[model samples]
Target: MIKSVIGLFLPVILALPLAAQEDSDVLFTVSGEPVTVGEFRYIYSKTNGQDADFSRASVMEYLDLYERFKLKVARAREMGLDTVVALQNELEGYRQQLADNYLLDKEVTDKLVSELYRRKQEDVDFSHILVSLPSLIPADTLAAYERAMDIRDGLTAGNFADRAAEVSDDAYSKNDGGHIGYVNAPLPGGMYRLEEAIYEAADGEVVGPVRTPAGYHLVLKHGSRPAYGEVEIAHILLRKSPEADPDMQKQRAEEARAALRNGESFEDVAAEYSEDDKTSRQGGYIGFFGINRYNKTFEEAAFGLSEDGEISEVIESPVGFHILKRISHRGIQPEAEQAPLLEAAVRQDTRFAEARKALFDRLEREYGTRKVDANYTSFVNGLDSTFFQLSTDLSAADRDATILEIGDQQYTTGDFVDYLEANARLRSSLERRFEVEGAAESLFDNWTDQQVERYAEAQLEEQFPEFKALMREYREGILLFEATKLEVWDRAGEDTTGLEAFFDAHRDQYRFPPRARVLKYTVNTAEGTDAQAVAQAAEKNTSAELIEEFGTDGLRIEEQVYEEATLPKGVTFKADTRSSVDQVDRNSAVFYRVVEMLPARQKELSEARGYVIADYQDQLERQWVEALRKKFAVKRNERVLAKLIES
Candidate 1:
């Protein structure tokens, strides 16, 4: 209730600024605290959007609401609500959330997402010979790079497919001469480097020794085509068996195709003939699939159909023979429609990390970061093999030694130690088998990056006026919510005597119109049940008793009270009387029993509690605002206000 109430007035609060120029004219003052003309104008134009006409009436109406809002905010501060630990924490949380969006290098992220979306419109046909790196040790990495370069050189003289078949480490594609066939971006995570290489290469151009996590790639771009986006297909499959003749399997597949051609529904034919257990019950549905998701032959057959509901001739694949019916096809979506998906994909890819690293680098330059190499070397030298065992305690080491300096802030050895201890679980993971010296160096780099990001985050409010304004709005919003809840919402709900008295004074306003308490009974007539017998039982007994007598298998009885205008159109009310049973349809009959006909009367407090409470809350809020206005001193500058309206 408090959030809903505050939401009604949030636009005004959210648009206001916490600070303005010292020389700006004061539009108003509440208890000696000034609200500048700049602040008021900013909020007014923002809250009203295009409706902020400089008309005097419009200005005055908003001024009144603004003054009331300020009065509540002032009262909240007087009560020390702003100093509450919970609210301060909440404000900080909101600040962090807002800062996360602002801290990114948005230009880089946008470029990546846009690139992915554009590339998604066309599928790339590419092949690559991957020389797998045995490890990330310098020698192994250098060897892999050299080997990939050697392969690229050989590709210029010899057949690419023959070389790939003999030497490529990618087992899946090497047999097909490194041809992975058509693929679209965004590719899986950690594959961004390969994805980039594939899309950037020209037709028939062999590029790379590109470095990816898996190893180095020597890529050959096999040209491109407009993407075959996705297809929804149902297929009937006849599996190959050594015991059965190949001709028999082919005959079965042809029979299924003939049934489909003879005007039988694809769903019925597939259920009767498809041997794929997973899809047989679901009408052989394979759902929607795109390139690289299935074998090249199956995908080609499925996407080859030009029209929905078109069936393919029996096609052979490695696993079985299939007769496919194309259910639907979806082409590439427009950029705007695809952007959100592209953005999500980009974030999951390795490129997002590179973008963030770029952001950190920019911040490092701006903040004048300098490393204390001597101190970092000292810290790393002090570590032992126990570091990976989570047993190293850096507390006894040089706590005062500075490892990095960013602007006026110094990150000491003690801070680095704290970060390491905090990440002990990650440091102890089975996948990380780093030596002590190497581990310490890696941790130090990460710690330095974290320090740089923190320093940048700390300076956001000071550096960005828009960020400061948002923080101020959220702070005041929290105060206003707490104040209103305490003074109006909670009081109205908890002060039972006051609520009852208020409802009593306004009782006539909540009187019920002429109404009836009715019991409606429905009986299923399709089973030859007697509708007349059900109606007779409903007239004589209460709904619960009727349910017990009829066993409730085909009888449904409900009791409700409805005003005259709201009752069913043909329903007539009379005390202790039942309406004639009427056939609602061929299979159902309904009757209504009027338990009591009620005339207009005052509603009890319990009968209208929700509405009464809402009204009571409004009354209390008005009184509270009036009291606050009396307590606070509000003085508006008429000359400035007049100028604002004229401008």
Candidate 2:
């Protein structure tokens, strides 16, 4: 019975770890339970493949977690909270979610990865010579045309590369004698236009004075070749970066090789001597670089060196001090590796994800649960509740107030909103999202976030498994909104008492930005017109000067990019008073005298009232809900759930 929870792993754990063939010697104990090095090695090999993503917990950690899980399960069984209607329903839902994920594996992802796995990639090799043409040349047309024509004729004559040297104006290739290097090789994706000529041509065949956007290209076809399986080599490098101190690097590389040969660990030497931080820590152990992954200097050194444990002398490159050890090599073709691994990974993920979802759906259908929120409305179906409630006091909050007193604690809604915006956990929670959304809507738009969130959550949960992850994603987003809608805001009664107290306590939050509604005129056709011409044009049309001395400098106008307080850092270009803008657009431009030129500045709270309200509501409701959760007599009873397998 204890085995079922850890069933999938027991064999490997007990087998001394056979996760892979190479590191089958490193062992790890499962807590105090005696385990062997073989077991640890096997786990590490499989896990190492996934090490780039550290989000997933490690095998050792998971083992420790298992111990905690056992203890928790015992406690949960003793409490018997699992039998409560809500708790039972939630558990069943999770179990069903688990099963539905399995079905998905069977239905979708597995098949997709398998199909993609069978596909083949065709590797090709080719080379070409290029000629760049000047755009609309202003030189002597007759002379330039004659020179270009002569080069073309020479290219058609024989030994095109040699002709390219003597006559081709492209100075880069003229010296190299027109060898474009390896086919379809290490060139930037944007610069590989010559591949078309190379791919279509036969070996030793010279083609094209083909004209492309870059220039005229005289291409010689090198035959297409498939990619080699893979290579294995060990190497030591001497780097040549000015920052690398070349002589020191060469000496280090030499010492590294000597240390390796003298029985010191390759890993230790690499960590101490390799200048490249990313690989040096692993003892110069770079897993595998394929195709044109590395630069020529390092790639050649690594690939050209001989087999396992063998080390070469210092090789020079831009990022220097390389000492390498070749572990093993695989000739496994693209199709070979992709097909099986892709198929297996896809199958597993699809089945697990889908079946878990299906299971959840079935459970929900069998024993339904209802979800409720602060709006006094039921958001999810399948439950009974007599009355819904929203805090009446919260509904009346003053958008201008800085500190909202809830019981003894005073909350700064502005401060809370900033915190919420930055919290990673708050942004990711599934069920707690909708209310926050409602708050935001009520702020920027007239829409009430709580209402919108309720409807959205209800509709989405019904669409389960189809968009569960998506719904889960929105669950947090929407709650963040609902939280923005909490009723604590209504408690802000407006009056001398309210305003005086609010102003005195939180007066600092209300600072107004320097603002002006200076008149602006839009000059639609002044494209590249000098500033003086613009002012003259304005004067001629409206008898008012938009700028005193406008000329080539462009129009000098008062503009907005949003509120100054909220303005972005550095030079702002937009209008609206709170924030800075990098550049001004037409929206902030106003066309109108000294008496009527400047407009009054707005108070920050008044301008940002909508935003403040929404943010405040979210903080209130989440706090309220958390308080209620603590008050509830919640318990977890796993007896019924545990009975399933036993039965």
Worst 10 residues of 1 by lDDT: 14-23
Instruction: Summarize candidate 2's per-residue lDDT along 394-438 as a digit string, tens digits.
Output: 221332233222222333434333333443343334224345444
The models' CA-based lDDT, in order, is 0.85, 0.45
After superposition, candidate 2 runs with Cα above 4 Å error: 1-127, 136-150, 156-158, 167-173, 185-193, 211-213, 222-226, 229-238, 241-248, 291-293, 306-310, 318-321, 328-332, 335-647
Residue pair clashes in candidate 1: none
Candidate 1: regions farther than 4 A off: 1-71, 74-80, 96-115, 150-179, 202-206, 333-349, 352-358, 429-432, 459-473, 490-508, 517-562, 565-572, 579-595, 603-613, 619-647
Q: What would you estimate as the lDDT of candidate 2? A: 0.45
Measured with C-alpha atoms, the lDDT of residue 414 in candidate 1 is 87
lDDT of 1: 0.85
